[model samples]
Target: MPQAEVDTPLDNAAVEARRAAARAVQTAFRNSGVHAMLEVATTRAAPAVSVTIPLGGTSGSPFLGGTGLPLPDGAGPLQQLLEHHDIHAQVTVIELGPDPALLVALTTGDDALRLAALVIERRSDAHDAALRLSGVFADLGITEDHIYVADGAVQVGDINVQDAITLYDVLTGQRNDAAELDLGDRWDPRTWRDVEKLAELMGPVVSKAAGEPLDCIPHPACRTCISSRPHRITLGSASPQQVLLLADAISSANSSSTSGVSPPTG
Candidate 1:
């Protein structure tokens, strides 16, 4: 008969080191002012933190065409109609998980705030758009409570710091997969291309929001929010000294986001 295996307790120093690392990451994110979510890794997994940074920007014209496909035409009917009504619209498409979701930010020149009323009108065509948008959230397994819409932005996703770091590691060739994070097989690193695209699209927006250029690095030492440039440092490429310098320079910035906003129920 085989004897059962027993777990070895972590040394006091090792335990303290782990606690210190966790606290450092949390404090860095808190001081940086960007929106981030913290999740405790499972006991069997390496202790890690995941962060998600939402990104959005203005669209000059309608993104979708008559057939519901994206079009590059600026003279589209929707654009003309919106222009006629003096509404300024900004649209961003983001894929944090599997499916892409549309975020439409609308503003009007008039002081009456007709565009705001249109967003809330249940009987209008906006209701159909809301349902379609809601379906994207459903596909991503996001609950209504986690959805936030305010200040011309719609933010979805649980926004885990560990997951973001893992994905960044995988993207930058620092790791093959997030297996050490124990996020399960469903959290496939291969399918995170959309996430990369989202980061690329929103990198400028995040930089503007942070009031400085930022880079996406897996290590917690870099306090900047997630944004990438051609010369951005990765965990696989940065030296300990460089990482420390980045931590100091990036820590000077602040970030913020709206929370507890009610999601529209259509």
Candidate 2:
């Protein structure tokens, strides 16, 4: 005989509550301009949503204030939205300055890169709420080999905490080697904002290397962007010697295409 279905009053109420929460989150996404990304992410069973909204220009932080429960700084509203409604899906937020190309990459890339990108974004010191966010991918069982940087000419495969640190060392070491490294002609057409965007894209790799617990601090070059660490390091603030080193590191990354190195995996 087939098993009889059981419907408890509590179960029914819980289901209704979850549906309601999903609707509320959806509404927020639509109104906040995050709807497009949400729709794309939701199409799959395990979705990785990546979107870039202007800083200090949105109604509330992507993930606004939640019940007394804590939230990471810059964490999108998706986390609380999911937990509030008892939704069991995995949702991670990545913060990047306005760059249409990044949004495109996030949406089109494979799951591993998407996940790595999120890990990279989460490093920004802008989000100061909790240490609760680190290891999110690992906790979810996403291994290091799964994460990588796929931009042209720059391929950092299997980017994990240690690999991120190594990248940071490589750049910083290069910075120290030359004080006034040229960014090359390719970078001539770009503005400082564009340079900042490149820093943001690469910030995860460097920040993860330097910050304890694998978090990232914004490059000193991006001093104007909304950030929690005002006293953070920047090429401007770096000592004469340090300034040269910082420049060389950035120049190397900017100039090299298809020449990124990945640390040896155990």
Candidate 3:
């Protein structure tokens, strides 16, 4: 009978090397302004990490008047909209899988009913509201192809890193283009793994930088409707530095066999 093959356990040196690698990855994430928690691999799952980046917004209520809304020194489009149109809303950056999308929660009324009536009645008020909302998004650097309106919300998908950074600056009173990071040319990820990892890291960072949450109004009907569906946000951009760091970490972790360094396997 052939002998059963057994996996060799990592030596102490190999184990220490893996630990150092993990610490390096964690430090890199921290330097990029993201908080990450590393999860040791289990029998049923691979090693993973969860991150929390600064997303500026009201924590309790996702409304402008609510606590923790980072108002800019100058009035941006969102502020302008509230001051001029009296449209109470919330703006948040969210992650829909590997994509980053923008969510604009319109006024807390029966938006579905109002929008439906506008289609039939052809009322100028509703039409004007839609136009104004579109303009607001446009002023925020959202293009037409990325915009979608449904269920009383406006979602802008496929936003680049610059767009998110600009929004963050507007909300946090930071200098625009402070990082000088233009990720447009490097936006296309080399692999799905890279895409997924970038999504995981960038989502929280961008969202925190923007500081907003998707606070839907507490209308019974609307709440039910919202609960019935899943919420999604898409991010379409990542910095080259971020990508390179992530790639290095992933490569090191995955090449454990060749490097004789076992990854965290709990």
Which lDDT values do the candidates have, in the order given? Answer: 0.33, 0.32, 0.35
Alpha-carbon runs more than 4 Å astray in model 1:
1-133, 160-176, 184-266
Q: Which of the predicted structures, 2 or 3, would earn the higher TM-score when compared with the native? A: 3
Residue 172 error, candidate 2, Å: 72
Q: Name the 10 consecutive residues with the lowest summed lDDT in model 3.
A: 213-222
Relative to the true structure, candidate 3 reaches a TM of 0.26
Ranking by TM-score: 3, 2, 1
Off by over 4 Å in 3: 1-130, 175-186, 190-212, 215-266
Native-to-model Cα distance after best TM-score fit, residue 160 in candidate 2, in Å: 57
lDDT tens readout by residue for model 3, 154-257: 33344443444443344333433334432333233322233333344445444443234322111111233434422222533323333233224334443553
Root-mean-square deviation of each candidate, in angstroms? 26.7, 18.7, 27.3
Please identify which of the two predictions, 1 or 2, would achieve the higher lDDT against the true structure: 1
- Report the lDDT tens digits of candidate 2 across residue range 1-266: 99986433334544354334334444433332222332233332222334333334332333332221134343444455434544333444444444211121132223323333333333322121111111222332323422211111111223332333334444444332222222222223223343344334445544333232222332322334424221121211112222233334334543442255533211
TM-score of every candidate relative to the true structure: 0.19, 0.20, 0.26
